[model samples]
Target: MQTVNLGILAHVDAGKTSLTERLLHSTGVIDQLGSVDAGTTQTDTGEIERRRGITIRSAVTSFALRDRQVNLLDTPGHSDFVAEVERALGVLDAAILVLSAVEGVQPHSRRIMRILRSLRLPTLIFVNKIDRVGARTDELVADVRRLLTPAVAPLGTVHAPGTSGAAFRLYDPRSGGDANRLAEALAEHDDRLLAALVDDLPPDPSHLDEALRAQATAGQVHPLLFGSALSGAGVAELLDSIAALLPTSPSAEPEPRARVFAVERDAAGERVAYLRGYGGQFRTRQRVVAYRREPDGRFTATRGRITRLDLVGAAVDQAGPPGRAHGPTALTAGHIARVTGLTGVRLGDQLGSPAGLDGRSYFPAPTLELVVRPRDPARTLALHAALLDIADADPFLRTRVAPDGGTSVLLYGEVQREVLTATLAEVYGIETECGPGRLVHVERPTGVGAALEIIGHGFFGTVGFRVEPGTGVDYRLDVELGSLPLSFHKAIEAATRAALDQGRHGWPVTDIRVTLTHSGYWSPITTAGHFRDLAPYVLMQALAEAGTRVFEPCRRFEAEVPTDRLGPVTSYLVRLGARIDGTDQIASGWRIGGLLPVRVEPEAQRRLPDLSSGEALWSSAPGGDRPMSGDPPSRPRTDGNPFDRTEYLRFLAQPRNRS
Candidate 1:
């Protein structure tokens, strides 16, 4: 049997979740159609999801379509939950991008399509809400070509659109014009077909059908379809396209290989990992090694044993307990499964071998940071541990602790902030007091500098580093990596970035090159512990000598306000330091788009409604940093003031740091 790990994505209110429900019901997986408004959807089983009427986590369900077993992953659509969508992207075999016919092309929709095309992942566009007023398929097709891609093939046509009686008619491949159109669309990328089309030759209808399917599979062409997931219109044609056009799963490799895209816990409190099999099969109770792809492009292998395995068909509540899973069996390649007992497995870990991962991130790191304190104050340690656990579940949600024992976490925007606050109280039972959001700025070296500490210089290990401005975190060594014990080397290398996390001015330093200029240790006395403490001590000295400059975070924004209210909205945005780049007249309002300092973004969003009398729409995504013209903001000193050599050494002597 063939398997397809299909992902369905969309902007919020685009009806992707509804489409998932429609597909499930049509395939006999659900007895009754699920409703998002009613919070009865099969995939959105989370408490917050049901309450907010939005998907915050990626949910999976499986159903058989003729010879293909479709494992459908319904991903979150809110901009704040892009991290959920990002994880799903790494595991999908092909995707169906749902767009609202009424909204036409949206900001987030464009972002999703851009990533899909960049990955060259096979995509099929489904223009939904054909039954809603103002729905226009004819013009939206042109918009998709102009804004998203030109490699689009309209798989069918819509009739009686924008009404309750709307219907869809798929193109008949056996017809003369339909066959010619398919051949012509493929000809844009196929030289042979282009030549035959130029000669006015009638290509074999079956051959054209095969060519269209092949091109779609290759991601060179996207077959577009129209539908209303609510009314169940155009769904049959979509299933037909999936079974006939999408590529089937490949055979498994001899060495079991897979990539963990998500991690969850069952009611019994077991760590369950969702892995996309790439090269091999994982069996029950099988001993295995997992290669975790760290954020720094380093792959670390950890050993674990698979205690239990479950297929995609049986799943409920990625957060808690659910339907009985069918497993404790072998999970072969091309299939997705929930496996247990691999406690060391983390999200994005490559199991068995790294066959198809590049270790490059598609999303930017969060720039907003907020200092958080538990309302009870005594739950401080609990809050920190809870944060670490949450970060483990979704690596993008990072946390940092201050020297004063205060806690702070990275967040994307206001929505995430609210979600985090609610989650800590709801899930962990930790009521929290969150401070005002502060934009996280970064510092980079201003010049080159170096520092050193030899073994006899008050420490057990000898460490030194040279620092210079560069991109990301580049750590090279003047000495061989084999010069010291691997564990010792790992200690210093790991602490190198942690040292940079809090520079002399109290901001995370970036775009720096650090080289190990000296490495020596006493044979018996020197250990990884000594190196960990000593490395940071030396690195910070080098960074202080080099000096650093701070830059502020910015965001790209799109806003739509009533044409008459545009002036007031623009004025409010400008007051928040937004730079207007372009403005266009949209159907319902004036589409005002620009770049703005992220530090002022939250305030802008808060006031946008009042400025437009609650008739405006706005969205913003992360943007490149801008040079700070004024004094740089200082973060609450985390890392116990690592720049203070004497104080830091004394702090390291404590039992907590010693471990």
Candidate 2:
């Protein structure tokens, strides 16, 4: 049987989990449907998810659709859990973007659509909750086209959509304006299909189906389907479309290569690495090399064996346990499963192959920082260990230990802070107090700068670098091949990355290009470690000369408030340094959107509730970095003159000094 990995994504309360349950039941995977409200859904297995009625983790389950095995990944809808969604996106073959029929398109929906487009993942849109009163499929379709893409083609139309048991007209190429438009769109992509249509020879159903599948897989077209996951309306038709339209997993290579997309702890506290086998097969007890590229352009590897393998949602009989094996067990390509005994495996790590898969930043840098202290200081080590586990699961939860032995965590927003606190208390039995939130900032080189350094203290080597602004958030490094041996390239790259991690202001540096313009090495005394140590000195000197620019995180925000309070809200937003993009009248009242510093977001949340009489809906997400608006604050530069050999040597002697 063929395999298809499908991801179900949506904003919160858009019935994403309910759709998963409906899909499972409609395909005979389960006898009865589970309820998200009742906390009985198969994918929402976590206690926190059950109580909150929201998915916090990405969960997987499988069922049979026709002759194909479909693996469904139900991801969290809340923006705070977007990191979870990013992890799942790397492994998905296709996606179903769920939208609420009554609410239309939302802010996060547009953000997710941009990500999906960037990944070039084929997608189908499902306007769910057609059973709800005031649900308008036509308006919702228009909203999707306006906000997301104009390439969307509706597969069906609804009749009396807001009523119970509404009727649907599934698209058939033989009739209707919608069907004709779909054909024309499909023909635009295929010359033969267009010629056939022009010759008065309508393409056969098989031909049209093949063309549709080809176009959809290439992301040239997106099919739109309307339904209510709660009532199971139009679900079977959706399934048929998926089975017929989406491409199956391609054949595996002779040598297996798999990407580990996620790592989690099972009930037994054993590390479980969830991987998608891109090629070949994985057998029990087979030794495999797990490797990942470090930021410094070095590949780190460890050897391990898969002690066990289990399908994600295998069923159980009266005599056997869940996820039982019926026969010889070996995970083949085009399958998703968990393996045990792979230690030191990180997210985005590749196994049993040297595919040179580069790591990708799925989410933006976290902006909120909080100092955490355990109630009992003695439990500090325990708190650290527990946080490590959480950080492993969500890479965005960056943790740092300060010089004073204080622990600080970088987060996306307040909700994540609350969730982390609750999870620590419940899972690890550790009580912790958190300090007030602060905004995290990053620094970048403003202009061209250069530096050259000669090692003197029993170390014989010289390194030089030219630094300049880089494109986007990339930290790019290039070496002159003639200046150094090929073997030393990795070391140089790694050292440069380490140097970039700390700017003069003690923040990570971004969007900088460093080129190794010159290098000289002498004998056995000169080693990679010497180069690593010498790198920071030259890089920091160059950064100081170039001058660093500090950037604060900004967010694009949208809020709907009563018309009577529009003036006050607009003035309040402006006072918070928000650049109002536009204001429009809506059914609820007035909708305003603008960009503002994330530092003021909490204040807006606190004040808006009272200002709007609790009738406001607001949303915001990271909107990239911008230079500080006013004159750049005077921050202390590196102490002493970097060009002074004596002073530089003394600075290097200090153990805590980056050099």
Candidate 3:
């Protein structure tokens, strides 16, 4: 059987969990449906998720449709858990975007749509909650077309009963007008279908299905459907559509390659690495080589064994409870499974033969930092150990121990902080108090700068560097392959990364490019270690001469407030340095959206409710870094010239005094 890896994504309260339950229950994978509100959903197995009624982690479950095995990854919809959503994207073959019928296209939904487009994932939009009052399928479809992409083609619609919410009919696409329209839309993109349509021949169901699959796989078309997962309406067709329209993974390879997307410890305290096998086969106790990219742009390979294999959605015996281990000994390609005893396995690690599968390209940076204090100061080391475990599972949560023996955790937002606090107290039995939150800052080069340095203190090495601002959120190092010896190139790149970790302002640097313009060393005295140690000094000197600018993180937010309070709210936001881009009048009020400093977001959240009498709704997400207003902050330049041997020696003698 072929395998399909599908991700179900949406904004919070969009009924994504309910839809997952309906799909599982309709396929006969489970005897009874689990409710998200009741905290009984299969994917939401975490206690914190159940208590908060929100998914904090991405969970996986699988079921079979026809001859295909479909793996469903239910991702968290909350903005705070976007890092979790990002991790799942690297492994997904396709995605299902859920939109609420009543609410229409939300802020986060639009954000997810952009990411899906960037990833080039074929997507299907499911308009859920058709059973509720004021559920206008037509308006919601129009909203999606207007706000999102115009390439969306509706597969079917939901017809609601007059009196009852549960009784509804999902018109078959074969008999509806949409079927013809869908065929036309698919024909516009598929040459074969277009030729047949132009020949005045009626569309064949199989041909149309094939065309839809082809167009969707290429991300040329997105099919939309209407349903209510709560009422079990339109669900059967949804499953059938997934089985027929989605593309299946290619055949397994003779030598297996797999990518690890998530890593965590199970209830038994055993480490589990969740992976999707792109090629080859993996067996229990199989020997595999894990390959990871180092800072110097090289692959580091480590040997490990898969001690156990747990296939998702394996069948349960009649006499056993549901979800009991079926004990699958091996997993073939195009399959998702959990394996144990991979000690060095990390997120984005590739296992087996490294012929395919790229490393993780996206890593969400934590926007908020919290100072954590343990109730018992004596147990500080234990708290740090516990935090390391959590950090290992969720790389977004970066933990650090301060020089003063205090601990801090970098997180996404307030919701993540709450989840962390609860987890620390309940799971690890570590009582803690969190301090005020602060926004993370980054530094970038303001303009082009260059520096040349010659080692004088028995180093016997010379290095030259040029610095400039980068375009994206990446620290780029450019050097010709044969510019220098391979060993020197490696050492220079690694040292450059270490130097970039801390800017002169004591914050990490981002979006900057450094080039090793010239380099030389004496064969007798110069070594890779010497180059590595001296590279930082050269890079820092170049950066200081170029001058660096500090940029605080910012987020764009939209809020719906009463028209009467719009003037004051707008004025207040403007006073806080917000740039209002647009405003639209809604039924109840005005919707305003713009960019603002994240540092002031909490204050705005607190004041907006009171200003609007608790009648306003708002949402925000990371919008990248922006330079601070007024005079751009700059780091102190080095007083002595790097080319002057005497001045350079004096500067190195008292680096702290020179700056």
**Per-residue lDDT of model 1, residues 408-431, tens digit only:** 888877887888888789888999
In model 1, where do residues sit more than 4 Å from their true spots? 173-185, 191-207, 314-328, 455-458, 480-486, 522-527, 557-595, 600-620, 646-659
Best by lDDT: 1
Q: At residue 573, give the lDDT of candidate 1.
A: 83
Q: Which regions of candidate 3 fall more than 4 Å away from where they truly are?
A: 161-164, 172-213, 253-255, 293-300, 314-328, 353-364, 448-496, 514-539, 557-576, 579-594, 600-620, 631-659
| Residue 167, model 2, lDDT | 61
For each candidate, what TM-score against the reference?
0.88, 0.83, 0.81
Clashing pairs in 1: 256-280, 257-280
Q: Which candidate's TM-score is highest?
A: 1
Higher-TM-score candidate among 2 and 3? Answer: 2
Encode model 3's per-residue lDDT on 399-418: one tens digit a residue.
66654566878887788889
Q: How much is 25 displaced in model 2, in angstroms? A: 1.6
The TM-score that candidate 1 achieves is: 0.88
Q: What pairs collide in candidate 2?
A: none
TM value for model 3: 0.81
Local accuracy by lDDT, each model: 0.85, 0.80, 0.78
